[model samples]
Target: MLAAHFDAPGGPDNLYIKEVDRPVPKEGEVLVQVHASALNRADLLQTRGYYPPPPGASQIIGLEAAGKVVALGPGADGRWKIGDRVMALLTGGGNAQFVAVPATQLMPIPPGMTDTDAAAIPEVWLTSYQLLHFVGKVRKGETVLIHAGASGVGTAAIQLCRLAGVLPMVTAGSAEKLEFTKKLGAASGFNYKDEDFGTKCLEATKNVGADVILDCVGATHWQKNLQCLNTDGRWVVYGLMGSGEIHGDFLTLLLRKRGSLLASTLRSRSHEYKEELVKAFTEQVLPYFSPGGSIQLRPIVDSVFPFDQIADAHRRMEANKNMGKIVLQIPV
Candidate 1:
């Protein structure tokens, strides 16, 4: 088996493909021959030594993958069989040609979807779905604000909000990205580099403000995010692309707005929790991707790079140049 490994934590230049031992499935796990995997911010952080895999997880960097089930471990449920097409959310190790994932994390690929596209769904889409439905508790007719609207999760969040009959507003750094969000069903988009998105969101909602706010930019946007929230609003923070320090009177602001502040990270969660999330998402969202379903949530792939070019894929994501997921096609 071949996988991308870094000599040391630093830049993309340090990454190289190396032959490694193939992983074996544990009880209740499935061995997958990976066809494709997608990039995420966590991958970059791991490369730089900022984020490490959870206890007993593979040291490989990828967080999600799509592949075919080649074998099942003892005690695995009978729902899956050899050669079933599946995608999975991983705590780590999706970069390799083969990985062993808990059967509970495996999701069947839709009838018509390709492996490359299915590879892009698990991480971003699941994160967006969890934030919107579980953490944010968004309801129909509510206005939701999403930051970094051009990101993989952002694109997914926009579409999910629309599916729930909620109005979504987004903030991006470029005009083109804003337009992209609008096409995905955002009610309004703001270029945060040029405008105060908080003020714009409030005005667009006729001063009522957004009912739920999904933010990844931590300290830099903290104050403004509070200002944009409606009373009893929920603000879910999943990442701190910006610095993590809070400089303002955050407690006062939270009390004043009656806001519910939540911090979440999927990678660090327990296996049981992830299993529950996968089950809920499989039931509620996966059907939409099936043939003849009411909605088709296609993954917006920014670019695809061959396995050997994994370094370039990391470079693209690190530069913030990609509009959606950057995929790596692993050759079998």
Candidate 2:
């Protein structure tokens, strides 16, 4: 099997294609014949040595994939038989021809969903769903602000908000990206490079302020996000792309606004926690993407590169040139 491997990460240039032994399914695992995989910021971080696979996870670089089941472990049920199409959020090792994923992590691909499109759905959708429903506690008629609204997670979050009948105020860097998010059901969009997103969000909600703020660009937006929050609102911080460190008077702001701040990372969660998220996503969120549902994958595939061009893909993401996911096609 050919896999993207980076023995020591420094840059995308460090990634290379290697002929590796295909993994066999262990107990409670299923061997998937991967067709497509999507890149995430985490992939770029993993390539640059800042992020590494969790303990006991594969050292390969990818977090999500769409594939077909080729084999299953003894404890696996017949529900996922050989040749079943599925998509999953893997901890690692998705940028390969095959990967062994825990059976519990797999979700059957919808009847008409394409493999490439399905590949882009899991990680971003699951992250958005968990942040909105579980962390943000977004309810219908509420207004939420989402940064990076043209990103994979941003795209998914917009649609998820629509499904929940919640209003979404989104921020993207480009006008075109803002338009793209609008088509995905974002009630309002802001170009953060040109406007103050906090003020824009508040105005969009008629000065009531956002009920929740799903933020990835931390530190730089921290003060504004806090200011934009509704009283007792939850500010969910998922990433810190702007600056990892923050130097705000958090106690003063929290006391003044009476709002709660939550910083969450999905990757480092316990197996039981992840399984619970998967279950909730499958039950509550996946249905919204089903046939006739309002929310479905609208993958903005910026480009597809061959396995060997993994480095170039990372460069595109780092440059912030991609509107959506960058996929690496594994050759058959």
Candidate 3:
């Protein structure tokens, strides 16, 4: 088995592929021969020594993968069999050719979807779904604001909001990204680099403000995010690309708006929590990917790189040049 390895944490240049022992499945787990895996911000952070794999998880870098079930561990349910196509959310180790994941976390690839596309779905979609439904508690007819709209999670969030009949307003860095979000069902898009997105979102909603805000830009946008929320609105923060520290009258602002400020991270959660999330997502969203389902969400892949070119994939993400997920195709 070959996996991406880093001698030290720094830049993408630190990564190299090395032959490693294949992983074995544990009880209630399935061994998957990975066909494709998706790159994520967490991968970059791990490469730079900012994030480490959870306790007992594989040190290999990756958060999600699409593959075929090759074997099942003892006590695994009868629902899965050899050669079943599946995708899974991982705590780590998805960059390798083989990984052992809990059977409960495996999702069947929908008809007509390729392995590369399925590989892109698990992390971003699940995160966005959690932000929208669980944390934000978005309801139909509500207006939701999403920051970094061109990002993988952001793109998924836009589509999920549409599926729930909620209006999505997004913030992107460029005109093209804004247009891209509109096509993905955003009611309005703002160029955050050039305009005040908080004001623009309020304007788009005719001064009503957003009922929910899915934010990744953390501290830099914290004040504005609170200002853009409608009374009793929910602001869910999942990423802090800007900065984690807030240095203002944030408590007063929260009380003034009477809004809820929630923060969440999927990677650090317990296995039982992930299992519950996977189960809820499977029942509520997986059918949308089926051949004739009413919901029409799909993975938005910006580019695909071969496994050996993993460093280049990281570079693309670091540059903020990708519109959606950047994937790596694993050669069998």
Candidate 4:
């Protein structure tokens, strides 16, 4: 099997294709014949040596993939069988022609859903789903603010908010991106470059502030995020794209507002945690992809690059120019 390998981590150019031995399914794993894999910020960090794979996970770079089950492990359950088309969430190793995933983490692709598009659904949607429901605890009729509204997770968050009857305010870099998010159900979209999102969001809510804030941009929006949150609101920080520095007095703010501060990274979570997310997503969330639910995945593919163009994909992501998910098609 050919897989992307990084001799040293730094940039997209560091990724190189090489033949590696095909992995066999372990007692509790399933070997999948991968059709497509989607990109994520975590993959960028992994390439740059900022993040490492979990113990016993593939060092190969990929977090989510859609594929067909080629073989089941010795102890694999009967719910999944050979040739069953499924999508999976994983810690790594999705960039190859074949990757092994725990059977427990697999979900059957909805009927009539394209495998290529199914590839785009798992990671971003699941992450945004967990952020909104599990962490943010968004409530109906509440105002929720999401940053990076045009990105994969952002788009997913927008749709999820709509399904829950919550009003979503989104922030992105451009008008076109804002328009894109609106189509996905954002109630209000703010161009983060031109205006203060906190002020705009406050005005959108008539100064009441947001009930929950799903933020991927950390430090840069830290103070503003707190200011924008309503009393007792929860601010969930999932990523820090701007700067990791802290400047103000958080202790004073925490005590004064009685607000809750929570932060986490998806990759660092235990497998049990990830599996639970997968199950919750499958049961409570996956039905939205069926038909009537507004939480359908649009897959907003910016471009599909050949497997060898991994570096170019990384460059595109680094430029922050992509409007949606970027996919790498594994050569047959």
lDDT of 4 by residue, 195-312 (tens): 8988888899888888888888988887778777888888888998987788889768766667788887787787788889899889987787887654564556777888899899
**lDDT per prediction?**
0.92, 0.86, 0.92, 0.86
Error at 27, model 2, angstroms: 1.1
* Tens digit of per-residue lDDT, candidate 3, span 28-105: 999999999999999999999999888899999999999999999998869799999999999999999999999988
On lDDT, the leading prediction is 3
**In model 2, which runs have C-alpha deviations exceeding 4 angstroms?**
294-297
lDDT of 3: 0.92
Better of 2 and 3 by TM-score: 3
Candidate 4 vs. truth: CA RMSD? 1.4
Per-residue error at 272 for model 2, in Å?
1.8
Q: Which residue runs of candidate 1 sit more than 4 Å off their true CA positions?
A: none
- Higher-lDDT candidate of 2 and 3: 3
Per-residue alpha-carbon lDDT of candidate 1 for residues 151-176, written as tens digits (9 for 90 to 100): 99999999899878899999999999
TM-score of 4: 0.96
TM-score against truth, every candidate = 0.98, 0.96, 0.98, 0.96
